[model samples]
Target: MYRLMLHGGVHVLEGTFVNGAFHKPLFFFCQTTMSTETDETRQSLLLEQESRHTANQHTHTEGAKMPNRKGPSGASRLKKCIGLFFEILYWLLTLILVQFWKACTAVALSLMLTYWLWGGWATFCLMIAALIGIFYNLQDSVLYFPNEPESSRLYVPPATALGIPFEYVTITTPDKVHLSAVLFKQRAELAPGVPTIVFLHGNAGNIGHRYMNLHELYAMCGCNILAVDYRGYGKSEGVPSEEGLYVDAEAAVNYLHSRSDIDQSAIILFGRSLGGAVAVHIAAHRHNRDKLAGLILENTFTSIPDMGSVLFNLDFVRWMPLCLIKNKYFSIRKVSRIQVPTLFLSGSSDELVPPKMMQALFRICGAPSKQMARFEEGTHNETWRCRGYFSVIRQFTATVCRPGSNVMEPSPSPTPGPSLADYLGRVNMQHQDV
Candidate 1:
């Protein structure tokens, strides 16, 4: 019998059981013609597949080898360079315009001086007009002294340098200005009821300059201190203005209210010099006036107009209209609106703000309770360094803010002192004797 089998796509014929008996060895014959045809077809198919694969690989390799022309081109680079050049040109033109304006101002002033010296009435009138205009435009710069000390603008030391535990905070005003502040907490664990002081510094320097004073206040009063740099001072953003400072103070107070660690009810506003005016503004207008524990004003002027009269001593300047005074911190007018307990820290020898100003404020204050402390040898800036300075503050805070109470206790009325009229009379007599 003969049988056919297929192997590897080729046909083979096999013979067995020859002559009615199975043969021990089987005989096989391959179909050579069919096998040859299948091998040729397979070889052709393999060659075609290899060619397709090689072609795809070559195409991919060529694509990868090609440079990416979609990247930044020469024209884009040139455009960027041109944009940079124009920006530099714009700044240069701006600087030149500023310098030219200054030069023109100088020449105009010189001509006005010459005409005035020669008794030219018409030119004198013109000079006065020019001066008024200049003053109106530059009043903000004149009133704010954030960079008076050169180092104030260049450097602000961290609160940690004084070995006090502090957190650097940024507060945002409603007007979108960012204020830099340092919150100094006690080294030991602080009670939730501990009073927090919002320290508003004077006009001249950043909060860093007040760190030593803050350290002393923190230790003596045993209160958390929040020292803030007003707008345009230190790392704060924006130019300083009278309204801006008021909003900044409000924002700080709101920030204290937001914190869980702070006692919002026992918050105190401490202001020195220009800061006193700010403190008065906030205390007068605070929506949560009942929550405020106290207000502390040190060596603070009564008003900008009063300061003008004292500082210039010129009849025209002294009588200048309030409308013409652009930056008017009229604290005297606002103090009567404050409902919180108040402390007036005065320096008798203060060369800047007269101690009489503090006295006048104390007399006018509408707080439930008020007290005045005078340091005889203290000057405007050194009052805090005087003995019993912190003691007075400690006593005042203790009286007003009771521990573990969210609502401040009503402080007892302060002991009566000399009347404002009597104080002024004594001051006048002293001056006359001098």
Candidate 2:
């Protein structure tokens, strides 16, 4: 049966040609023995049938070797597209969930705060709003809040109301900012070794706001007093800044030094609150140290960031970076460089600047002699009202300064420090001459 199948007529003969083994003579012989068919028709039919059978067999073999290749290729491309879509969807969902979590946390915090402390929470919300506003408009916020900048016409200092005659003087800073100042002096001859107090007042009001302290210092101590208005505060030109205020202080010192009536060697820098930081900054300068007699700081904080923590008493702001605080009067760092004698007057009950910060400053002082006068019953603005305030100032000056003692002691070569202009130039603060 197998041999008969192999020899099975013309179909079996066609297989030889299809397999590429038929000689031309064998094919011609097979055609001639088969029939007298036309050569063209027989060749054409045989070639067509053989070509069709060869193609079908080749395709069947390929299909067997690589089953489902076309179907899987199309399916894989579809799978890739679906996977990319789902990946994008997952990230979108994650982003939405994160935003929703933040919102929920904020709402929960607000509700808890409102429940526990209604008034404080309201104030906190207001403060948050104010901070957001400040972040958006820092320049205007610094110009406006915490400081009351009024025109000179609005406030006038009483020069002679307390019988200690004071002269209204105008001075110019190195930056050419004009400042209004009051010079308080005894009409009578000043006692020997009596110091001139270059008073720098606190943050909020003009120098005239300290009339009580001025009157008391003059009547009680009989010392020379010169108080100047910082820029943007009580008739001074330009906006207020930490460096601008420092320059105003320097200008005040220069004005006092220029005066022949006032002794340069007996100049004492007296500052309260913000003024205290400015005074310390002035006294820390290598150029100003020789001319200064002594230093006095009352109710001043360590730094502006520390003061913010103290002021707000909030955990969130307690960790506020010092770089973010625009008005960074870092008195603690500056006080360690002050070479003169220092007197730190701390009110036990100071609401704004805590007594601990003052004590920290007192301990860090690098002065030859430093003392702290504690007012047990005093507060921030009323430390001068303490019974021994004037006496402490008088005694401190008498002990630290002497007549013709303007000569500075030979210390280590002083490191160069940043000038007021240099400090202000680095930040986003601009002050124009008026």
Candidate 3:
């Protein structure tokens, strides 16, 4: 038996040669002779014996000779001691790295759950790296928002014909964040006390990207809408922060409330993505029952941490630098305190913020007129543009999203998928129906 060190690690082997047969964990390029019964049998037996005796015995013998030359030298003893210390240290570090690998594995397993619900190429890349035992930097690889703002491909109506028109309105927060806004209302054709809503854009381009929502709420659903850009977005000035966004939302909502053309009794606040948390903040603290109507939250979650949990493999992060997330954007903590009708929208394929996290927000809401609708294939920003989202929002506006009334349709379960096979089957069924 022998213990060997190679390939930066250690291996143990035990072997024997008997009746010209070999057994060993080591391999060598030597030949051995065996008594011949037949040519094939003799060759096989000789190879087995050679394999059994295989090892770098030359190297071992050389080491043994060096010790013999030392002849009880303290230098030899010292060298042996140093070698032994390093061997133990190497193994200890390896063991620690192994434990780290497992911790990384646990974190990967948690992310697999989210990936299973909303499979994406990025998640697949991360998972593949994990399975290969690579020490991937989850924060550097995953928790980053891209540096440059993405350009939107849609048009911003020079004056969005939302109804009550002021020409390309410019509004400012008390803290001096300038928000460019457009308001729409029809007093007689649109009921004076009819539900009024505000549009909060996602963390992408300006209000132009939200035109589908604007057109639906304003022209089709017959609700007054005030859509504004947060700071650092669209024509809005100043950089955006969690608190700064709230101030922007407040400025826009207050702008509507102050308007004589738009009725305050029917005022509703709607937020998308980051805006959803902003809306919750307003509904929880700033909203007056006498002034505001209801709430609509689309593709939003409980908080930034709740979002981080969904977006990344979080177990390792539960103790890591994730603790430094100061801008909580925590809506779930505040939603239960809100006192109005609330409608929640979630997207089945929302990779940025999975649909399941919405359950936390729904669970905490205090309003009786709370409704949640999920678009089967919608991601974070486009839930309302999905097939059923427009109709759902329109219906919500007509019924539960009404002024001074906290009424809502039953929210669907927040579970995400049926399968790709299922989506294909439905498409074929729809063709048959046609």
Candidate 4:
């Protein structure tokens, strides 16, 4: 029997060799034929592989020579266009609603003011005020622009964005609304008399909106910060009302006061814009006036009516009866009663709240020793960027609030104080069965 084996396309025929002589010449011929066939097959395979490799290279080169388009794909562009259209439509609808709301509010206010101008009695004014207060119950929805994250919206936590050590505080207001706040602790051991600033932010946005302010306070002002979001803002619960916000501010003050690490007497209430009004309201309250060390108001307006007047450039808005307004942050009336050492800071070129209004507020401020810092050519948001912003605060704070100093009493005034009776009457009227 003869055996044939194939290895790497090499053919081998094995047989007993008769003294180095071929047993069958045919066998040798067959083996040589097989070997030749195997060599030819191997060559064909190599040629085939080479041809395939060349074809692949040619195809790749052709693909590479094609035009390079850098923008989005046609499908992606269509999608983006659709999304933009929807966004525009949504804003358009929102604007229409806002315009309608404004029209209604303006007409109502115009009539009330017109009547008051035509010798409307206090009783008639009170009736008009009640109706206006009910109308503005949804005012928060219009005023507050919360930075709530959804879709492409951006929101960064205070600790991460501000680059400061902070704690998320959940405060429950007396009305049982859960409010979100950020408390930035001092890095070093706080000096005995050094204070913490309870930062009350403006009408719109959350506590995180004040990250720059908090960062500056932490780095330059040498004061720890505790900033709270009002109801319906950020993570806070409930709708915002004038009284509800006051309760929120009280809750913040109380939270800091409860902490053993904090100096209750050294706590300073710092407010900017609408927050300035909140701080003034809190400092003016009978209970909180003696508790807080000082008040720092920056670029704040007098009241809502005054704000509407300035914002709209309407002379009639200024003449509107303030008692009829709900959500009245009447800082002008309240500022005159806040006896704590106060600092009134404003930008000379503030567009939102006129510098003159801040000056008027400073003039009427009942604080025993108050200082005014004006940044010429500074706009509303740019007040802190003004020169000597932090220095002025530090200097003013040092004199007014030493750790061991006694709480100052409210200075006696020759003129009668602003009455909250009309304001409270309006609020109570809203709750009455009508």
In terms of lDDT, the poorest run of 10 residues in model 3 is: 425-434
In candidate 4, position 214 carries an lDDT of: 66
CA lDDT for candidate 3:
0.63
Residue 9 in model 3: shift from native, Å?
99
- Best-fitting candidate, scored by TM-score: 1
1-434: candidate 4 lDDT, tens digit per residue: 24454544454454434446544322212234443566676577457555655665576579789987787799989999999999999999999767655535434545566666775676466657556654565555555565443410135354666555678889987778998888887544553335778998777767766676567656655666888888877777886777888889989999888887767778899989888888889998888877888889989988887887767678797676655466678788888787788888788888778888888888888887777777775688777766666667766667767657332221122234322221121110000111
What would the per-residue lDDT of candidate 2 be over residues 1-434, giving only the tens digit for each residue?
01111221342323333345432211222324344657796578567656766675686568678855455577889999999999999999999867544434335444445656765766667546544434433533432332554544366556555555678899999999999888876554553335688899887778777876677666555577888888877777787788898999988988878877767778888898888989989999999988887888889888876766666677565466655556777887888898888888888888767789988888788887788778776799987776666666665767777756332211121233222222111111111111
lDDT of 1 by residue, 209-278 (tens): 8877776676666778899999999989998889999999989989998898877778899999999999
When 1 and 4 are scored with TM-score, the better candidate is 1
TM-score of 4: 0.61
Please give the RMSD to the true structure for each candidate, in Å.
17.8, 21.0, 23.9, 18.4
Residue pairs clashing in model 2 are none
Which wins on TM-score, candidate 1 or candidate 3? 1
Please tell me which model should have the higher TM-score, number 3 or number 4. Answer: 4
Model 4 weakest 10-residue run by lDDT = 425-434
Total clashes in model 2, counting residue pairs 3 or more apart in sequence or in different chains: 0
List where candidate 1 sits over 4 angstroms from the true fold: 1-130, 286-288, 402-434
Q: Local distance difference test, per candidate?
A: 0.77, 0.69, 0.63, 0.70
TM-scores for every predicted model = 0.66, 0.60, 0.55, 0.61
Go through the candidates in order and give the clash count of each: 0, 0, 5, 0
